[model samples]
Target: MKRRTTERKMTDKERKFLVELLACTPSKFKRWMEGAQNALVLWAASMLGMVLGWLILAWLIHLLVNLEVGMRSPYALGVVSLLAPVCGLYAICSSVQWVRNWPDPSEALRQDISGGKVLDETYNVIEAKRFKEPEHGGLIYFLRMDDDRVLVIYDHESIALEMEGENALSSSFEPRRELHIVRAPSTEYILEQEFSGEKLELSAPVDLTVPPDQWPEQESWCEIPWLELERRLGMPGF
Candidate 1:
């Protein structure tokens, strides 16, 4: 009886531990390395891989073969093996480019949670707007909330609001392609309802309880072009 009680207790504790671990914003790999000194070890490895790949590509192209790619043969086979070097170089370049291109972790995290897999598999949230494309394509803007920080809460998904920054963009492109804009109040933005017509109408307001973390460091941000925003949301131009 005592052994059974102990086993049951252990199982309950294990279950609770897993639940808390899943309730985080950063991924498990990231959270584990958040404060660990060993995190730098992985960083160094990635850097080394990039550098080595670059060097290998340089060697293959400049030193290995002095002629153009030829038909399949023993020599060609050897040279073909060198394709790994070219692929490796591309990977390194891509990594650097990705870092240079992204706005911040905010955008990546928002995309991950917006799919709503964090809370439940069946739940997903989408931003909505209206637009029309006539002579050319139109533009529209989507507001990303700079204030909200989403932690993966109990497998619940998140619908991101606001952007990392704000900008003034073109409303339309041509005479035929025109658009209308409906703005919503920043303070009253809700997670529940989907936007309708020209106004922001949110649903699932009940699902949107208090966000887990406090506001993000920045207050509000946007990622949409005003015209594109309308087009994406299926709004027609009048």
Candidate 2:
């Protein structure tokens, strides 16, 4: 594999554009942490509510029927034990469904970009490179958004400027449409795609900040215009 040196550093405008884009998107780890935290909270609350409901039901049954009812009673123990599996099953199913229905990480970013919420330029671009492989090449951007955050962007050339439902309804579908960006820590070398909220681990993590001579493989490294990047990202014309 021929090793091609990086063409050039990002221009000021290009850096600003990247920074704005990064600002609009959350990192992959952060998103996962948030989802886990939410699920834990939900589970805890549900379990607590179930316990209280069980106690209330037991009390009502004893008051209405004049039966001896206590947590240690055989009847209460039997009922609670039976309900345990049902509650566990319900929690497991609920979590699975919630995860399956979770939206792609880029969904919110796309919405923010379309809604003009990407104007907040909080992140600074540390480094950026645009390159393509020899075969089946499309534009790929490796951007260092900060000291720790790195973004690997796959720009689908085929749908660079295509609009939704432009062609016939049946032929309008495109696999992995528009842009897919993977955000990871600078220390991480493996690339992951959060497609439909599922992490699909791809290639090893690439640290692009190193000299091009030390890069893993040689490819056509070049610069992309800010406007062109915007078009590829499905952003409206400025």
Q: Report the error of model 1 at residue 223, Å.
A: 7.0
- Candidate 2 residues 65-171, lDDT tens each? 96666575777777767666666666666766665666444644444334432121123344454444222323345554443344445445423322342312123
Candidate 2 has its poorest 10 consecutive residues by lDDT at 183-192
Q: Clashing residue pairs in candidate 2, if any? A: 2-218, 3-218, 189-204, 189-205, 190-205
Instruction: Summarize candidate 1's per-residue lDDT along 1-238 as a digit string, tens digits.
Output: 0101011111333334333433643554553444242334444565566556655665566566764334333455655456545545555555555444533343434443333222111112123222222212222223322222111111111111112122112222111111112111222111222222233342211111223232122213323343343333343333
Best by lDDT: 2
> Which portions of model 2 miss their true places by more than 4 Å?
1-20, 27-29, 105-238
TM-score, each model?
A: 0.25, 0.34
Residue 8 lDDT (model 2): 30
lDDT of 2 at 119: 23
Q: Pick the candidate with the highest TM-score.
A: 2
